[model samples]
Target: MTKPLTDQVVLVTGGGRGLGAAIATAFAREGARVAINYLKNKGKAEALAKDLGPNALAIKCDVRATDNVASMVREVTETLGAPTTLVHNALADYSFNGDGRDDLKTLTPDHLTSQFETAAIGGLNTIKAVRPGMEEAGFGRIITIGSNLVQNPVVPYHDYTAAKSALLALTRTAAVELGPLGITVNMVSGGLLRTTDASAGTPEAVFDMIADNTPLRRVTTPAEAADSVLFFASPWGRAVTGQNLIVDGGLVFG
Candidate 1:
């Protein structure tokens, strides 16, 4: 749809560290000028931008706040040109430890709210910010990071899974509305990744068990999942939209 990766400006939310960082790195590797958005990990973001070369930059923004997101997009546009690609990878402070997660009765509304703010509302803000630029150019690529738990909730991550489900809904609906404008919206869902700051609390035994059960016999890594995100942003994905491609090493199938 848009020009090749070398001619694109890409913005990735929560791109300072963990899986977000991996996704940013992937875009940079493909020669895209990338904007790394971070809420708290400024140091990491700056360092990543530096390592990615002059085509990349680090910006601070809280995607949950619409105003903050608008400012960040403006900065990216000013610094790297209007972003023709976007990746909604921001995540609330969360852990994947099933034992420590709240059960159905114990989960609070606030938990759901926090997750929804980041996964859904944050996505809404970023998408809106970039849509205009994409529409002007008549081409855009949008990819959201989701979780396979929505389809196979093996650990019962109620709040996190619920929010991700809503994001999936947003991704599909946005695709339906944006497709005519030459914008493709899709999602890349991953199961328990081997290691990310968010999943560091996950027990070693859990990883081993997941690896044993997965058809690949190994937990997916951040880079592997990041690669899937890249595919959706490339010309190869021009015909695909409103779809969630699970990148969990075949742990669970749709």
Candidate 2:
């Protein structure tokens, strides 16, 4: 069996654990050289790279900083090859507890900016870093993790939702600009994953509520969502770009 990603070098930011880790594993399974980028949690990142075997490496970078992102890409290229695929999964520290979340009155610009720094701005940094290599090769795939909350906003996670929305807009516009160069930009939006560090704080009741209401009768798993990200990178997705693929098990319909 042939895998389209076998010849590719992939950089997955914030790929030390949870959904990011799952995405790295997916790429590794396809025989792609995987660079697991992490800002902290060195042990988790290294452990995952080791588990992915010889072709994968763990790297560190704060995607919000262009210089750091550039350096990170250099290291990845030197070690793994110029990254032809990038998944910007790095997220700022945040908890998904609705009760503790900032409402309009309590929400400050700082709160939103913090999320934007990692989600929106970080997405920009990675894309720019990889643009030259992708343009040179005339082939690239850029996938950014997004949130279904942008459309549903059931719980009103203002900061998080706003940042993801911005990323989605970027994905579409970048797709247009990069299309001529053969690089496709897309977003994969997932609802509260069954369990991740970010969503672990959610009460079990909320999970049950989501499951009971979702058409699939279950919450989306990190691995399941990771597979959707895979679709946007594979050859089958070469013609698809600037589209947001929702992986929330039909919980929120468009």
Candidate 3:
């Protein structure tokens, strides 16, 4: 049997660690050439590439910078071939410690902007950088990592949730525009993934509460969420576009 992504090239931003790392590994497992993009964690990214063997490469680029993003994509194309799949998983530095989070009143515009720059604008940059290649190839898979909080907002994470919400809108709009180009743009929203770096600061009680509320009685895993991403890139999702797949163990419907 042929691999689902054989001969495919994938670029995963912020793939140095955590959820991004898991996504990159999943793609590598599926026989895709993987480019792991990192901002500051060169050591971790290189290690992951090495672990993934010859099919993976470690690249350093700040996703929020358009020039850097363009350069990164160009390098990935030259090294691994023009990416047929792009996963925008880069995130601004944030800890999921609700008690220590900035309340609504204390939330500044800069804080929101920072999150938007990394989450929304960073995705925009990657999409733009890869659009030409995808359009020329007439096949593309664009997956943005989102949060289930946009649907439930249970934690009131003002900046992060707001930025992801905006990303959802962009995903839909891009889907409509890119669909005709034979490219599918979608999002995979996972809730409180177990043990990701972003969620490491979450209290144990909060995790317990989330697990109790979910139908599966457990939080989603990054590897599990990564599977959904693979779906969009696979032939199985050929006709699916502009949709969000919530992988939070039934915590949020639709």
**Over 4 Å off in model 3, which ranges?**
1-3
Residues 163-237, model 3: lDDT tens digits: 999999999999999999999999999999898888999999999998999999998888999999999999998
The worst-scoring run of ten residues by lDDT in candidate 1 lies at: 1-10
TM-score of each: 0.99, 0.98, 0.98
Please, what are the lDDT tens digits per residue for candidate 1 over residues 1-254?
55788888999999999889999999899899999999999999999999999999999999999999989999999999999999999999999998999998899999999999999999999999999999999999999999999999989988999999999999999999999999999999999887899899999999999999999999999999999998888877779999999999999888
Model number with the top lDDT: 1
Query: Over 4 Å off in model 2, which ranges?
Result: 1-3
What is the descending TM-score order?
1, 2, 3
Over the stretch 1-254, how does candidate 2's per-residue lDDT look in tens digits? 11288998999999999899999999999899999999988999999999999999999899999999999999999998999999999999988998888899999999999999999999999999999999998899999999999989999999999999999999999999999998999999999997999999999999999999999999999999999999989998988989999899999987
Task: Output the lDDT of residue 147, model 1.
Answer: 98
TM-score leader: 1
Model 3, residue 93: C-alpha shift (Å): 0.4
Cα error, candidate 1, residue 14 (Å): 0.5
